[model samples]
Target chain A: MGKNKKENRRNFLSMLGTAALGGAILSPVLSKAANTALSSNVTEIKNFEGRIEDFLGGDYTNIKLRMQDDVRRAMKKPAKERKWAMAIDLRKCVGCNACTVACISENALPPGIVYRPVIKDEIGTYPNVSKRNTPKPCMHCENPPCTDVCPVGATFKREDGIVVVDYEACIGCRYCMTACPYEHRMFDFGEHYSDGLPAVAAYDERPSFEYEKEWTRENKHDSPIGNVRKCTFCAHRLEEGLLPECVTTCIGGANYFGDLNDPDSVIAKVVSKLNVSVLKEEFGTEPKVFYIT
Target chain B: MKKIFYILWAVAFILGIIGVGMRLMYGHEPAAYGSRVVWGLWVAMYIYFIGLSAGAFLLSSLVYVFNIKIFEKVGKLALITALVTLICALLSIWFDLGHMWRAYEVITRPNLPSSMMAWMIWLYSAYFILLIFETLYAFRIDSGKYSGEELNRLKKRLKILASIGIPLAIAFHGGVGALFGVVSANPMWHSALTPIFFLVGAVASGSALFTAIFAFFWKNKDSEYFNQMIQILAKIVLVSVLFDLLLEWAELSIALWMGTPAHTAGYRAMLFGDYWYVFWIFHLLLGVIIPVWLLATKGKKPIAIGWASLLVALTFLGVRLNIVIPGLINPRVPGEALAYIHPRLSFHYFPSLMEWLVALFIFALGIGLFFIGNKIFKLTEDTENKAL
Candidate 1:
């Protein structure tokens, strides 16, 4: 056993040396390859389909184009027939918060309202420490506790499995906020970045077209202000044949969004894998969002 | 002393008017409650006042339904107290709403199956109407205008109304408890014990308030009848306090006995956090211990019993604050508190000055309503000489 351990240590050290030498030799050639690929931009779907083998063989695959394809494919089906889902790859996330920023801008979120937040966890003690970034958004659960607690019928799950809040009907009692285990919902306290300033800017006045309705934040007591706000999976954008802002803005290409009902769709393809885990599955919320470690 | 009380009420009323104006004009912008701690002092006060209302209403039923003659004189006062406190409770919750005007939607287009709040609203409405009619029948029986047969019929009507009110009060207040209890996310409140605790708390605090009023306001203070009433009420309040304490112990010890971090985080915060004094000093000491001591040591003394009951009634707000705040102080996600820094996203919370001012206004409004009710209607047995 002692001899085997010594031999194993030597083999590991040699493997490390070989890997380092290979990395040094390949770095320049990989850069040159990337440069050439960037220069020869073949950005058409039909041409891309014809050159699918070449694209597959290439080191860099454009995820945005792939996501656009996924969105288009899912849009062809009826809303009820398409079950929307999100799958997040934990390994790829750098916690740059681009997805969070994109969600805020898309939703016109106020200072207190955050529809998506990346939670950072530092695991293990100093010498063995490694960090994990988990971006949380509204899970749009099948058995949503938030919907059942709404005093008014202001929030409900749709046929296509997205939980939505009707700002006009919501009493702003915020019972739903307490009911949500994930704490994904936030109350818009009718505050703006330009609040308490001498003159509020026009950007603050711009209407956010949530649920395909024009919600202009004209005053404090208006709908969406003093109401529970949450991520809608960018439903308005989805209806307009666009991917959710978070999916498109993720720099690491960690987030996948598509019809879970379509087995051929990107999200549907990865979600059923053994590695995928849903947050608080023991609570039986049946969350549509899955995380892969 | 009476002049000083009036002066305090006047000052509170004026400041309260300003607070109401601020609330109406600015909405929840002036409050400290954020998205993280969604409920605040107003929610606490709302439950506090509602508990008092339900307690008082139930006590009145004890006389009319159970025919507890010792509490007969205060029965009418209890009903009136219920009405006044119910109004205060409604107003307290109304101001807490993000959109106060849209509150009517709760009744007009309520989602019955999904929400306990919808049921609470409907039940409160039914209870409100029943209370008004029951109090009126109570007044009619006391008016002495009817003959022997008519008076008996009026008494029968009052008993029937009280019988209906017993279940209605239980359902309405239990619905309030279920409103918080059904929240599976909040481990502190999600228990089979929540509704039972609320019911017991309502009785303890309600009877305490009724006892104080009897001790201070009853005309024949030196009469044997008065002492008998105070003794009985003191006993009721004492038993209730003990029972409520038992429920509280079960809630605390069960969560804390094993010391599971997830289950005990809220309780630990309540017992050891920055506002630990709220649970230990305010709720346990002033609300429970001191009152329990006074009731025990000086059970027969009207003055001591009155002071004990008064302290219990006033300090029960601390118990309410503990309930509303602790359940929400702990973040759901580990690093969610630090994920984004915003006042609304904050885990730590205390009511803003504006919130207190509004609460003062609500209490002053209740007093004013009670005084007006007393003057307009023969709400008390002694006030039979007044024109109805």
Candidate 2:
């Protein structure tokens, strides 16, 4: 009985070894086939020379798809080598604020903390008035004044030029909120939209995937609930080879996002070809966000 | 009168307890300060109490380091007041933190070189340690534990600590000023004069409080030396108040004259905004004019100087509020307040009742600690004269 058991074990081991060798030989070919299937639609968008106007006038889906492709390409480089940027074409924006809603939904943001807000202005007198909408996001400055004032070094600039707050480390002195030139940062006062409700909605209590960490607001004293939060260019989504929620949900195709270091990327082209201006440039913050007015 | 004070203290203490309970339970939900005008009464009170502590410590230094004989009687009392008020200041800012529990992170992992706030924390910690040692030595010498030579040795050590403390006090208080001053984003606070202004204000407010405490609380208030000390402290308060006003004038006049709207907006809001009375009524009328009048006209009378100094010390919070709030009233981006319309996003600010209660609690806690400490340590005892 012992001899028969050993012989059965040897037969099983030899079969497993044959299977491992065969799988190794076939793995590369199978992965290549899978890659082709995944990128079949993406490959059609190669060498796209589309301007902001063309993208707006033509199929808006193409621009989003092109940006998705740009994001996928940028993810190949190391974080330090890539510089993420956003450009808002002011001429194309309508005041729908879908991006704002998308961000709120994406981040599970509580009351009093807004990652983006669309600023509306009415120019000229009553008879000749024209309304303008400007969506404001964190500028993610090259020399971020907000990061410099943090007493605990809780908030800092990531190598990819996105500014993030370490919720665990932030003392939440609000010194950064005061120091921000654009006033982009918001303090989470640990409020809830469902405060007075009979039962808390599941959506209101959902966790946000910020900085690739699951931050569930189960307790008011938890990290993101009391920490200062701002836009991270939808960093977690970017890691999954997807565009920022604001960029994808922009109704008028107004927002552009890609790696600025890549000269051929859509954002790099839009920034260089257009006469773009940054808000509060005189402060010398050198904002990564640009606006094509 | 003492019964009335005790009743008030008890009431404030009870209310303050309720406020702290709400703060722990609700977080910042019950507070009014928000993203726009980020700081409110708590921050103002923090500077106010800290200024008092710094001011009191420096006055104590005059007795310990310089050996100013007329100031000798009130020296130990001044040290205890410093210690108590320093605790109050720490509590005020500690509760103001969003994650009050995580406050130790500032010590554990600090970003010193780039952040003015980090420098302020380090300096305050150092100053706090130096103060404890100095107070301990001063009290130990008077504890009747040591004889002639040992007492002299303790006195020498106290003097050495006091001397180290003078620079430490100046740096920490000035560092507080620079914490606000270095924010180039707020043109109002961004100035070379801010640190100097803080030091002067500290001396003014601190000396005024010392004078008041001496006038009202001294055991032998009827003594001739009491009158002499009060007179000298009144003079110090008067000169420092004028000096502080002079700095304020320079800061205001320069900004108002030939300055662009960006630079002048904060001063405009301060001098003539919704809460203009903070500057005009509370600060100018009560804090400056009335106090100055009493000190100048009734310089010789201890009772009159006490009232004047009390007025100055209490209303100096108006000055602190003016410094913190107006710099934040104007939007960094024009029309940003209208852009996002939440109660928390707006620029308008008034201290919520919870905030006031929390502030009251801190003040009561400080007073309570002072009474307890005084009882145990015989803080105001005439040990020095007995030794002499």
Q: Using DockQ as the measure, which candidate wins? A: 1
Cα lDDT, all candidates: 0.84, 0.86
* Candidate 2 displacement at residue A292 in angstroms: 0.4
- Deviation from native of the Cα of residue A240 in model 1, angstroms: 0.9
Off by over 4 Å in 1: A1-61, B375-388
All models, DockQ values? 0.69, 0.58
Q: What is the C-alpha lDDT profile of model 2 across B1-388, one tens digit per residue?
A: 8899999999999999999999999898899999999999999898988899999999998889898887776778888888888899899999999999999999999987999999999999999999999878876776678888888888888888999999999999999999999998889999999888888999989888888888777777777777677788899999999999999999999999989999999999999999999999999999999999998998788888999999999899999999999999999787798887899998999999999999999989988998898788665654453222
TM-score of chain B of each: 0.96, 0.97
Worst 10 residues of 2 chain B by lDDT: B379-388
Angstrom error of the Cα, residue B343, model 2: value is 0.6
What would the per-residue lDDT of candidate 2 be over residues A1-293, giving only the tens digit for each residue?
66755454454334433543657577445434433443443343222222355533333458789888889999999999899999998866766788988999998888887898989998877544556788999999999999999999999999999999998899889999989989999999987788899988788888999989999988878888778999999999999999999999985578899999988788988888877899989999999999987
- Estimate TM-scores for all models: 0.90, 0.91
CAPRI level of candidate 1: medium
